[model samples]
Target: MTAKRSKVAPRVATGGGALVPLPVGLSEKEAAQEAYRRLDRRVHARLGAAVGGVSVIGLAQAWGDWASHLALSPGKQMELVWKASRKWQRLAGALGRDPDSE
Candidate 1:
């Protein structure tokens, strides 16, 4: 006798180009693993969206600044100033800085 496969369709689509169905008739461990996998994918998706939004907003602001500067200086070129910040003072030791100095 041949084993029969269920004809139910998947309820969710995953980023890895596949459909993920609800875990049914699975043991406690198996169900928990499946839930964790779905949660991980969701977290990654949200993070990607946040990073993309920040990137787009930064580009838009930079472009606006460039346009305003160009308009104000018709013939002269605009000078750019690069600013650096040390936000990881606490993590300096982890980044190869001397503990005593930190």
Candidate 2:
């Protein structure tokens, strides 16, 4: 007879060597967000400036888009939100898949 495993399975390695698990029923988006947060911390430790620069660029782009629509057409902001949401969803799906399958 063998002993059954009990703890939640860890998905990624943290910088300080901590193990963390995604909840069993996390949605793809939520899981991806969690994974990104975890990975970002590790990446930040290694490439803090580069990560900060890229993040600043992303924020600037988002702010520009929001400001552009905020004046001329506020309704279109919703579209931007959906577009970003879809991009994240795609990212989530990609994260959940077998990387070698592509």
Give the top-scoring candidate (lDDT): 2
RMSD of each: 11.6, 18.0
User: Model-by-model lDDT, in order?
Assistant: 0.62, 0.73
C-alpha positional error of residue 40 in candidate 1 after TM-score superposition, expressed in Å: 0.4
Best by TM-score: 1
Residue 39 miss distance in model 1 (angstroms): 0.6
Please report how far candidate 2 places residue 33 from its true position, in Å: 50
Clashes of each: 0, 0
Q: Which portions of model 2 show Cα errors greater than 4 Å?
A: 1-72
Cα displacement (Å) at residue 60, model 2: 11
